[model samples]
Target chain A: MRILVAMSGGVDSSVVAGLLAEQGHEVVGATLQLYDHGAAAAKRGACCAGQDIHDARDVADRLGIPHYVLDREQVFRREVIGDFADTYARGETPVPCIRCNQTVKFRDLVALARDLGCAALATGHYARRVEGPDGAELHRAADPARDQSYFLAATTRDQLAFARFPLGDMPDKAAVRAVALRLGLAVAEKPDSQDICFVPEGRYDSLVARLRPGAVAAGDVVHADGRVLGAHGGIARYTVGQGRGLGAASWDGQERLYVAGVDAARRRVVVAPRGSLETGTATVGEVNWLIDPPSEPLRCAVKLRAREAPRAATVAWDAAAGLARVALDAPGIVAPGQACVLYDGDRVIGGGFLRAPGSVDRVPAAA
Target chain B: MPVLGLDANATEPLRPEARDAVLRALDQPGNPSSVHAEGRAARRLLEEARAAVATAFGAKPQDIVFTAGGTEANALAVRGLAPGRRVLLGATEHPAVLRAAPATAETIPVLPDGTADLAALEALLGAGGPALVCLMAANNETGVLHPVAEAAALCRRHGALLHVDAVQAAGRVPLALAGADSIALSGHKMGGPKGAGALLLRPGIDLAPLIAGGGQERGRRGGTEPLPAIAGMAAAALAARPEAAIRLAALRDAIEVGVAAAAPEARFPGRAAPRLPNTTSILLPGVAAETQVIALDLAGVRVSAGAACSSGKVAASHVLAAMGLGAEAGAAIRVSLPWNAAEDAPERFVAAWSAMRDRLSRRAA
Candidate 1:
């Protein structure tokens, strides 16, 4: 089979290409030029793509597989980056990685793979795709710490059908490095990219402010009862259940305060006690079901954030309104704009983005 | 299956004559500038190649300045000549010319047929102070031939200097450098090796050197000459015959006609214009150029679309866009026949392309 591997000039994807090539599968490596690396480097005098692209080309040359860099800067800006800033401006913490995976990595690359006469599009994502009786099924990786099923839950059924994840079954990231070492790949020791690919400095607040200035306006941090407690530099910096960075508003005399909700229209960060931030139900919109959309309430485990473990929940689907109401068995912190990924055992049933509590329509942008 | 090589405009396959000349030149080891016996031999070889190139291209031996390649030659001409004159560029010029042009340079538009809009050029030339007008003899992507002779007449009337980039047109066609002040040529684009290119200057044209290193090529360019590549280039130029254009044009037209027959919706940009004999730009209505190039490669045929970036990714063609191709600019792929292309290349290419079209169209629907 001819496979198109999305190489980010990293160890995991490099290992994926090497392993696939070793298995006698014809592999083509493609890296996305997501933004103007030259312009970005000029802004801070930083060298980023000059190394990554060279590394990718080096690895491809060593493996004897042809590699190309796809220029997706325009599409990435419009789809992922713009959506990311817009989500923040609307008082929701954005998962840019998910947006990139959903739009550019999975959707666009899958189409490109077909256009290039490839059997499937493969990547280094630590998520599994199993062949179900009906079709391909998205599942969590064997390594729990590295499982990226939540970030990939939004991949469409057609995309999942043509997607391959060669690194999903690895015992851990160390094992992936071991495979790289075994393959004699130089990228085995390349430090794993921890920050968002575009945010080289890991200062997303500054990036959001630069991209959408209206989202960074001064806002009042207030108590849930409407008593103004303190001022914040921007509402974008606050996420539900975050207790730190409240400064003088860290405590409300008897109890420590946490961000409960953000009111973008009013430019207010609503703070409350930790207990008050927990919610029994989270309304999720833009639902994508790997399995069939259940006509009845489905019992499953729901993860409300990337770092959190899945908790027991019952999800009721509202097909007409395109929303899923996830009722957590125990009240937990449900942050708006974070993914509400529902899992049954190790398989992802469906997922969607959580909406702000008590909001009817789409979350309105800041005034 | 033998891979059909159809991307001549990107870089032509080296001729046997050029390869032999390069081999012979490589055996000699002395700087052309050294004053010893070996140096005298090397200098004799260099001057011989220079004379050959000058005679082949209708220039004087002293007028030819060798540079790294087409890009450097263009930069030397545009930057060297544009100190006191306003720069005017053809809209469809290659990045070599475009990037070297001053930011304030005005663009001359092209007609729908991909030829330079002479009216626009005349108007711009008439509107300006003394200008250095840059135009390409043949567009790299579309192969559209600009009327350099006519444009040169217009430039002369306006007291402007005309520089024609003949990188693609040099070996394949009779160059229209009449009354033009300078011409740029690339070795690789004309069946020679990659490292050598030349800027031909008209007598009395004051050219400031792009590189201020050791005084060479009459102080018009600098650095030690790449003798082997330059020798190969001169040999290739001497081997090229203007009569060969007829044979290549027949093959090019066959590919275009066969492809149009196979895929009726296919549109050939610059088909009506006087284009380079070996180049054809095929535009498929709804398919992307990148996809077409890849699909063709997978099917054992090699073609190119637009300008490939440093990362080897195909970008939308600025040449086709300048000709008002609109969305078709991204959908066009250039099929330029090399000097030694197989007689059956057109059949093989058409077969592969139509099969790809059928598969992609079904998927698109």
Candidate 2:
């Protein structure tokens, strides 16, 4: 079978290509030249940018298969970058990568594979596509330490149909590296890519500044009591549940306050105690189901953020409204516009966007 | 019908004689730089090939310095000339030249027609000083010939040595050693094997050797000569005929017309300027070059984006960036053919291109 492997110049993708090639499949390795607008792309250690392409090409040569680098910068700018800027402008924290996977990387790449006359498009993502009695399903990888199912929740059905994850069944990062080493792949010892592909140093503010200079407004940081704490350099720099670098002037005897809200209209950071961070009920929009919608309020595990552990929750689906109402047993920092992925064990059930508090009419009797 | 490859700019298949020459050279036992009789025989072969390449490009045999390929040849040219000297480079030179040179290097922009800005080159030259001025005889992506003679004249006036990376222009266009102080060429671009290239320096020019080893190429470049590849390169260069370019140009024109008919929005860069007869950089807006290349490949046709060196990465070419082609660069695809492409090559290319357009249009809609 002819498989088109997506090599992102990261250890995982490089190893995936090597493993697949060793298995005797006709593998054509390809790397997507996503966005180069960020200065970090030129930096030495940055992955999936300038240097990564060369590295990917080198690996492809080593694998002895035809390799190609596809330029998807324009599509990336439209799907990922534009959406990122607009989301920030609208006071919502957006996962640019999720949008990239759904619109640019997976969808565009699978289409490219079809154009190349390949049977399937494979990536190094640590998530599984399993064929079960029910049908095709997305699942967490065997490696709990490196499971990336959370980041892949929004992948559409069409995109997932022709996708394969070779590293999905690997034991862990160590095992993957071992396989690479055993095969004499150069990237066996390469460190895992951690930073945002385009932003190696994690300075999102500078990137946002470059895109929309001075868009981050300097504003008042107010305490939960509505008293002016101090002046903030920008509201765009702050996120819900953040405590560090508040730049607050006064706090005589209170615990370090977290950012409870971002009032973009007035350009202010609403601060409060950690106790105020929890929200038992979250209304989610843009719902996508990997499994059939439950006939009743289904008891499931809901993860509100990437690293957060799944908490027991009762999920009620409103098909007509295209929303899911998640009632968590324990209150957590459920922010607006963040992805809320519902999982059953390692299987991803579905996901949706968490609506901001007060925007949607909450069921008064339920709370 | 034999495949009419219009993608020589990407890479030309090795000529049969060149392939035989490589195989013959590989059978020899001794290294050319060694002292034994077998080594002397190998050394003889090396010198003879070097002389052949020099004669083909109108230079002294001593001037031809072989390297791994055109990319390395380019790197040597850009980096060897007056280290620490402020470098001035043409906008459309390959990335190997741009990346190896200093970031502070002044860029001499190219006109929209792919001609080098001689005035800009002169301005940089006048500002002068221990400086290395780099330009290409022709643009790799656009096959548009640059004003090498005019620019070389400016370099001579300003007392700055000129380094012309003539990798794409050497055989297709007439080359004279007098135009530029130094020139770079790739054997593969002229139907030789990959991994063979030469840097031709003027007789009196002094350059810092990039690789130091047992004195070879007059101690300017190091490592045992890739005798097989060099012999093949020399053989390929000698076989190049004047009529090749004329024939290639006609085929290129036919292909361009066919493409334009299928996609009216398609653009040919440097169409009106003097260009390599075989190369065309076409821009199909609202469609990616990679997409079209892949589509063509699926239909038993092959083409490439400009600069096969950076083909795998999907970023817009730095050449295009230097030309100030922001979005248009993304839409550009290059097609190049050898003089030997089949008679039916253009028609087949047109059919493949039509199919690609239909597929892309449907995908877009």
Candidate 3:
């Protein structure tokens, strides 16, 4: 079978190409040159740069398969970087990677695979596709610790049809590393990359400064009661639930204040006690249903952050408004613009964007 | 054991004389910089090789400054040129030249035929003062020859020093360093060992040295020289002849005609323009270069997608991009033959290419 493997120059992608070729399948490795004009040797990892392409090619040569690099710099700038910068400008932190996967990586890659006459497109994502009685269902990987369902919840049913995840069945990272070592791959022991592929050092501030030089304006840091506590360099530097480096003098010392909300228009960071982080409900917009949309309010588990587990919740989809209002059984800090992924146990049902707290009308509970 | 060698662009098999010279140099125990008898012997071999390389390029022995390879030679040329003045380079210049020069340097455009545009270059030089002009003698991808002598003369009239990257042309094409201020050559490109190359610096042209370790290469470049590769490189240069050109050209012509018969729509760049006799850049539309290269490899034939140095990159070639070909650049497959390619090699390549073309055509239909 002919398989088109998407190599991102990361250790996982390198291993994916090696494994596919070793299995005697006609594998064609391709790396997407997402952002060609961007600075190289940046603090961020060189995921889709010239060096990455060289490394991917070296691995392809070692495996005795064909390798190609596709230039998608314009598409990346439009779909990922532009959206990310716009989201930040709107006083919200957006996951550009999720957008890239949904638009460029999967959608564009599927088209490339078809052009190459390959039956399917494969990636190194740590998510599984299970053939259940109903249809193909996306599920968490075997390794619970490294499961990436949060980032992949936005993937649609059609996009999942021609997709394959080789590392899905692997029990842990150690097992994957072991297979790479056994194959004598050059990147067998390469350290797993953590930060955003574009921002390796996690210095989003400098990147933002370079992009929008005068966009970040110094603003007042105010308490929940509207008392001016301190001044911040800019609201873009802060995120919900952040505590350290507040630059505020701790006079009262009652409790370390956490950023509860960002008022972009006023250029202010609203802070409150850590205990005040909890919220009873969240309204999700841009709802995407992996499974059929619930007929009514159904009890399930919802994950708001990457590290956070899916907690018990009641999710109600409003087709008229195109929104999903999720009521958590246990209150947590649900920030606006963050992903609200719904899960029925380990299977990802669907997800949507968390809307601002007071933007939706509350639905009454069951009498 | 028979090895299916596809990495010709990396380094060719060393000539027997070159190998023996390297072995002989390996027996000598003294550094060439040392003033002792053994040192003098090593120095004599090094100077003789330099002289041979100089004579091969129609240059004086003193004009040759030996360096690591083509990359360092290019870096020295680009970085050594006067700063603050505009630097003009051909769009197809190798990364060694491109990276060393500032990204904002003015690029001399290349025509669709893979030849440098003389009008654009003349205009660029005419409009600027104190410019360092760079143009390669032969493009590594399409094997297209640029008018370096013409460009160099134009630079000379404008008081600009021209650096010619003759790495691809050294043994394949006759080189005369009369008009250009400097020229770069790589040993591996001409069946010599790797890690040894030379930069031809015209007399009285002072420039900054990139490496300053020891007072080697007349205090222009520093570091311990790889004497074995140097000896091999000199012997290979001296032994290079034009007879291989005629043979390679005939084989290349046969391959081009056979491939064209098989795939009628395939386009070969520089078919009309001057190019390296042993190289051809064929474009197979709708079929990716990587796919064709692999198919050919499976059939015991080898080709490349653009230069082997930048083969793995998925991005379109900057040379192709500079020519405004855009995504079509991905369709280019470069087949570079060595000077001593076998008589039946072209037939073997044509047979393999026909099979691949049949498969691709059926798939397209």
Candidate 4:
């Protein structure tokens, strides 16, 4: 079998490519030039090929496989980065990694693999594709610490059928690095990428400011009880349920406050007590179902954010509206634009992006 | 299956005669500037190679200024000559020349068929202070020949200096440089090694040295000349056969016919224009050039599209965009047949290409 491995110049993907080739499969490596790393790093006169691309090419050479760098800058900028900034401007937190996987990584690469006549498109993602009774099913990695099924919740069934994840069954990062060392790959000791890939110096606020200036403009931090607490540099710097950066307004009569909401239209960061930040129901739009859409409400474990544990919830699917109403059994902090992925044990059942709590009230109810 | 090379415009395989000359030159070990007996022998070889290149390109032996490559030759011509003059560049000029020009330099647009808009060039010259007009003899992507002679005549009437980049045109076509002040040539593009190129000047035209070092090449270009590559270039130039290009045209035409028959949507961009004999730009209406290039590479055929950057990714061509290709700008791939292409080259490329087209098109459907 011939497989196209999406090599990111990292240890995990390099091991994936090496393992497949060692098994006598024809492995071709591909790296996406997602953005101008030189410009992102603010370096002057730097060549477009950064250290990551160079490492990817070197690893491909060592494996005796042909490697190609595909230009995806324009599409990535339009789809992932643009959506990220716009979501921030609308006073919502965003999972840019999800957008990247949904569009640039899976959808585009799967089509490219087909065009190149490859049997499957493999990646370094810590997830699994199992043959279920219905068809191909997306599952969590054996190592729960490195499982990335939450970020890959938007992958379509057709794309999942043509995708492979060799790193899913690995024990952990240390084991993957050991495989890299055994294969003599140079990225064996390379540190894992942190934060957002495009953010420089771990300061995502600057990137958001450069993209959406209106989102980062100075605004007032107001209490939910109509009191002007203080002034904030930007609404984008605050997310729902965040406690830090509220200086001077973080405590009133020894009662700690957290970010309750961001009113973009009013340019106000609304802060209140921790109890006020919790929500019982989250309206999630743009729902993607791994299994068939259920006719009635389905009881499952729902995850509201990437790092959070799955909570008990009853998800009601409205097929006509293409939205899922996730009713959490316990009140939890729900942030808009964050993904609400539903899971059944280690299997991903469905997922969607969480809408604002009052969005349903803005629309007339069905008679 | 052996991979067939179809990207000659990017680079050509070294000719055997040129390879021999390079090896022979490498055996010597003296700088041309040294005063020893070995240095005298090196100087003699250098002059002889210069004479060979001068004779082949219709220039005087003293007028050739050796540089590192085509890009250096172009930069020397532009940066050295455009100090007091307003630089005017053709829309389809290479980035080597475009980026070398002053920020205020104006662009002369090209026609829809990929040829330089001579009327627009004349108008820009007529309205000018003394100008340095830069235009390529042949567009690299489409191989469409520009009207260099006519543009040179207009330059003379307007008292402007014309610099023609003949990197892709030198051996493939007869260079029309009657009134042109300077011309640029690359060694590797004409079946020589990679490290040598030259800027040929008219009788008394002198420019500042881009690299100021120990005076060499009459102080026009400084730095120790890469003797082996220069020798190879001169040998390749002297051994070039203009008649072989005619045969290449037939093979190239056969390829277009086969590809068009296999995929009816295939369109040739510069087919109606007077293009180089060995080059063809095929545009498949709905397919991306990147996918096409990669698919063909995997099928034992190597081709290129757009301009490959430092990361080895093909970008959208500014040349095609200037020719008003619009949406089809990213859909075209350049297939330039090399000088030593096999007789069955057309058949092999077409078979691999059509099979790829069928598979990809079916997936699209």
Candidate 5:
């Protein structure tokens, strides 16, 4: 099979490309120049693509395969980075990685692979694709710590049909690294990229401020009980349930405070006691179903964040509205814009952005 | 790699004349800068090569200033002459020229045919005082030839200087150096060895040196020259026949005509424009140039995308974009027949392209 592998110049993708090439598949490696690497990524100490592009080309050279670096700067800026800034300005945590994969990595790269006569498009993602009775199904990785299924929940059904995640079945990233070392890939010892791809320096505020100017305007930090706590430099700096950085009131030792909500329109960070931060219901919008949506409420486990354990939940999907209301077994700090991915055992059902606290038409939490 | 060399514009297979000259120069080792007898012997060979290179491009030996490669030559011309005059560059000019120009230099737009808009150049020159017009004799990607003589006339009328980047056109066509104030040539592009190029200046046109070190090339360029590469460049230039260019052009025509039926969606950019005889920029609508280049390479054919960047990534061609080739900018690939291109290369390319296109279309469907 002719496979198009998305090589990030990282060990995982390099190893995937090597494995496919070893199988005698005509593998072509492609890396996206997502931003102006030299002018932007390099000076900003961000995980820019300059060195990665070099590494990917080297890997392709070693594998004796043809490689390409596609410039997706415009689309990535408009879709991922621009949306990230907009979401942040709206007082939401945006998953730029998920958006990037959904658009540039899967959608655009899949189109490119198809145009190039590739049978399947391979990636280094840590998620499994199981051939179910119906069609290809997305599943969690065997290694729980490395499971990237949540980030990939929004992968469309047609995309899953064409996508191949080769590193999914591996026990851990160590195993993938070992395979890469055995294959003599130079990126075998490369450390896992810790920060967000674009937010290389971990300064998301600056990026947001630069992209969406005036988003960093000073706002009042108000307690949920209508008490004026203090003032914050920017609403973009705080996420839901974050206790610290609540200004001087957070250190007064009165009580542990956590951000309950953010009203972007009012430019206010609503703080409350840690106890008030829990929410049993997360109204998720923009759900992309991997399996058939259950007509009725389906009891399943759910993952609120990438690193957390799956919690018990009942997901009632609304087809017409393209939203899902997940009723968690216990109250969790379901942050707005954080993915609410439902899982049936190990397979991903679907997921979407957690709605703002009061935006779901006042659906009462199962207290 | 057993790859057929169709990416002549990138760099051609070393000509035997060039190879023999390089080997000969290697055997007689001496730095042309040294004052020893061996140095004098090296200087003689260097001067002979300089004469050969200058004469081939219709310039005096004294006018040629050797550089490391075409890039240095172009940089020397643009950066050297950009002090007093306002610079007006063609939109389709090579990055070597574009990057070297003053940041304030205005761009002269190109026509839809990828030809330099001479009217725009005239308008810019008329509007500015003592402007330097930078245009390429032949575009590296599309191979579209600009009206250099006409441009020179316009520059003269406006009291502006004209610098022609003849790197791609130097050996492929007869360059009329009398038309422009200066010309930049690359050795590797014209079947010469890498690491050698020359900037040809008209008599009495004293420009600043781009590199300042040991005074070489009459203080117009500095640093000790790479003699062997220079010798090879000149040898290749001398060996290149204008008739070979004509033959290659015919072969290019055959390739376009033969592959036309199979690739109905393929477009020839600058097809109606006066393009180089040996080059063709084919735009495959659905497939990317990188994909085509790779697929063809796998099938033992070697070609290149039009705007392959510093990292060898086939990015969208700004040249095509400037010419209004919106989405197709990234889809264009250049297949330039080398000076020694075989007769069957045309058929081979057509077959390879058709097969690749067929497989791609089927896969897409």
Candidate 6:
């Protein structure tokens, strides 16, 4: 069957194409041109998409498969980039890679793949799509360290059915790159993209300021107990758990203060002791259940962010209010706008965006 | 899947005559600038090519200045102008002319059908000091013919200079360059190899060198010419038949007829306007040209969208926008039938395009 591989001019995707082609599948490559490269290339710390398009095309050519560079700047800006800024403006930490994976990489590419008459859309994502008795099942990649299932929590069940991740079984990134080198791919030694793909300079605050003006509005640094500690340049610069960059509120009475909450409309960064930052429960919205909702409260492990282990939790889905109430066994900093992904062993159960600190009040009495 | 090439405007496949000329010329040695016996042989080949291209465009051999490509030819004509001469460019002119002209140069608008608004040109000329009017003989996107002769007549009345970019029109249409002071021609556009193009000036016209290297092409353009490419271009020019342009019109129309019927909402922009017989710009609503190009390419039918940048991303065509196609600008894709486009070419393209359209529509529904 013909497969449309989303080759991002990187080694992992390049190796996926090589492996698929070696398996005798008709593999076609596509790279999305998400932004203007001319100005992008001129920037001091550019996350070079310009060179990637060329590399992807060269890899496709070497593999004797046709490659296309699709312009998705308009769509990408609206769906991924715009959402990224809005999430920050609301005083929530956002995983831009999650948003990109959910929207641009999976949702859009899957549609494009179908339109091009391809049977499946393959990606470089490190997550497995297991064919289960119930159509398809999403699972954590075999390599625990490289598991990206946290970022792919929002992937709909239908999307998973049509998507393939050949690299999901690879033991490590080095093994993938070795396959690429063995396949004679040019990007075999290309460095893994480290920072936010769009935020090349790692200046997250500046980007948020530009996209959602006034997101970086100057505000006060206050304690959780209503004590005005000092002044802060912007609440957007402070995430729920960050301890540094609070200026005068970096410490309170010889105790280091961590960011407890960010109130955007109130224009304040609430700082306090590390103990105050812990949350016993998190309210998540826009829940995407990969499995059917559990009838009784389901006991599971949940991850609140990438690079963190899933903590034991009890998650109750209130379908009427379109929200989920998660109670962690041990308190952790449940940052608003961070993803709350429910896991059952190695399988993704469901996920949703963490609700803001104040939003817990809006939860219906039905829950 | 059998692959079919349909993107003639981007470039046509090299003609056999051009291929043979290039191979035969490659055997000869010596720069045209040299004074040796081999040098004279190279010079003769160079001048013969110059005369052939000049005659093809109805100009003297001395008027033709060889440059790199259509872009350089345009840059050479538009840049280094006599001081204080106001440069007025057509809004829909190719970027080669659009960017080459001065940043402060004024623009003349175009009609809805993608034709150069001659009335606007006359007004701009009438309102100005001695001006240089830059317009294409045919649009690269829609292939709509500009009113070059009429615009030139207005320029004559205003005592202005008229420069025509005949990159698309040189071989496809009759060379009625009488009123224009200079014209640009691209070899690749006419089935010749790239890296060779010429800017034809009237007998008395001359400009400062864009490249000041060892004096070549009478110092108008410097750099030793690529002999083989120049020969290929000359051979292509000699082999191009005016009748083929007329024949391709039916094929072009057949494509329009089939595509329009299959997808009624698809706007065939320049269909009614006088355009190159081999071109069609169709706007299929709800589908971006980038998607259409990719879909068709995957189906083994090749075409292109608006002038792609170095990175192959299809930006909304300024030409379509200038013509007031508003929302449909991004929807337009150029499907230019090659010189050797077969009778079944249109059917194959329309079939692939329509199937892709139907699938997308179904998915949307």
TM-score of every candidate relative to the true structure: 0.97, 0.76, 0.79, 0.98, 0.95, 0.95
Alpha-carbon runs more than 4 Å astray in model 1:
A43-50, A360-367
Q: Which candidate number would show the highest TM-score if scored against the true structure?
A: 4
Candidate 4 lDDT tens digits, B24-113: 999879888889998888898899989998999899999999899899999999998899999999999998899889999999999999
**In terms of TM-score, how similar is model 6 to the real structure?**
0.95
Candidate 4: list runs displaced more than 4 Å. Answer: A360-367
DockQ of each: 0.49, 0.34, 0.19, 0.88, 0.49, 0.58
Writing each residue's lDDT as its tens digit, candidate 5 over B1-365 gives 45678988999789999999999988767889889999999999999999998778778999899999989999999988889899999999999999899899999999999888888888888886899899999999989999889999999898899999999998888887597888999888888899999899988888989777888888988898888899999998998877677799899999999878888788999998998889999998967777788778767898887666676666778888999998889888898989889998888889888999898888778
The alpha-carbon lDDT assigned to residue B235 of candidate 1 equals: 93
| Interface root-mean-square deviation (Å) of every model | 2.5, 3.4, 4.5, 0.7, 2.9, 2.1
CAPRI tier of model 1: acceptable
Of the true interface contacts, each candidate retains a share of: 0.48, 0.62, 0.28, 0.86, 0.45, 0.59
Question: Candidate 3 chain A: worst 10 consecutive residues by lDDT?
Answer: A358-367
Top candidate by lDDT: 4
- lDDT over C-alpha atoms for residue B324 of model 1: 86
Give me the overall lDDT of model 6. Answer: 0.87
Docking class of 6: medium
Best by DockQ: 4
Per-prediction tally of clashes:
0, 7, 2, 0, 0, 0
User: What does candidate 6's lDDT look like per residue over B298-359, in tens digits?
Assistant: 88888888888766677788988998988888887899999999889989989999999999
Deviation (Å) of A325 in candidate 4 = 0.9
Candidate 6 chain B, poorest ten consecutive residues by summed lDDT: B75-84
- List, residue by residue over A1-367, the lDDT tens digit for candidate 2: 7889999777789888888888888788888877663345455534534766777887888888777777677777777877666566555677776777777778778888876667888999999999877776889999888898888888766667788898999998898888878877787787777657766568777767667554476888888789888888776677678887786533426676888887877878788888887788988877778877777999989999888889999999987667789899988897665789999998898887777775652322110
Q: Between 5 and 6, whose lDDT is larger?
A: 6
Q: Which candidate would rank higher by DockQ, 1 or 3? A: 1
Error (Å) of candidate 3 at residue A214 is 6.3
- The list of candidate 2 runs beyond 4 A from truth reads A1-29, A33-67, A71-97, A110-149, A157-276, A285-302, A307-332, A342-350, A355-367, B1-6, B27-39, B80-87, B119-133, B154-160, B309-311, B320-326
Tens-place lDDT per residue, model 4, A145-241, is: 9999999999988899999999999989999999999999999999999888988778988888989998999999899999998988888898899
RMSD of each: 2.5, 6.1, 5.8, 2.0, 3.2, 2.5
